[model samples]
Target: MTTMTRAELGALGEQLAVDHLTGQGWAILARNWRCRYGELDVIATDPGTRTVVFVEVKTRSGDGFGGLAYAVPPEKVRRLRRLAGAWLVGQQSHWDEVRLDVIGVRIGRCRIPEITHLQGVG
Candidate 1:
């Protein structure tokens, strides 16, 4: 068994998120996209709906603090929306719709990693 650091865990979660999104037919556009506002974990375009999705991934060892979904607060969602707007301003192409998504990753001892995706969060 091996112990994972916080950074390692976060990276793993983000990678898992990207893989999951790709599996769902989303084309990854960016990862860790940063700006003066904040950072977006994963940005993708949905092939089926032609929607631009701004994904926020939250990884945790357990629910010691709170459930994975609860990690992303209302203010965070608002900020993500702002980030999405900024990202859109820089994009060359257009999307039919813009959505805010949240991917919650939970890692616990002796348990498989749990991933939950909440689309159109805010």
Candidate 2:
């Protein structure tokens, strides 16, 4: 069996996040949303709160790099906010809430299924 590459691992993490969110009844507005400024891993709407979520997914192979959650810095949060504003402007939706969530995933050989969702992270 071929081992997955780093890119593949990241893709898996994003898919897992999307699935997790979907299970919670959030409709995916977009994925891998990109512009010259930055990229958002997942964008979804939760009917429960009627809020638009801008999610950033970070995946790591192990404890290295201080795990996935450590990857999100203040600057990245700012970038996400900016991109979300652009997305909102383009869609022309009057969102009641704008939430920034982070999904941190740790991939390992034993497949522990590490996932942590931090809502309103930014």
Query: For residues 48-111, what per-residue lDDT tens digits would candidate 2 score against the true structure?
Result: 9879999899876677787455688888888899999988989967788999999887777655
Q: Per-residue lDDT for 19 in model 2?
A: 86
Mark the 10 consecutive residues where model 2 has the least summed lDDT: 61-70
> What C-alpha lDDT values do all the predictions have?
0.88, 0.86
TM-score for each prediction? 0.92, 0.90
Q: Report RMSD (Å) for each prediction in the order shown.
A: 1.4, 1.5
- Runs of candidate 2 with Cα error greater than 4 angstroms are 67-69
Distance from true position, residue 100, model 2, in Å? 0.6
The CA lDDT at 88 in model 1 is 96
The candidate maximizing lDDT is 1
Candidate 2 residue-wise lDDT at 96: 88
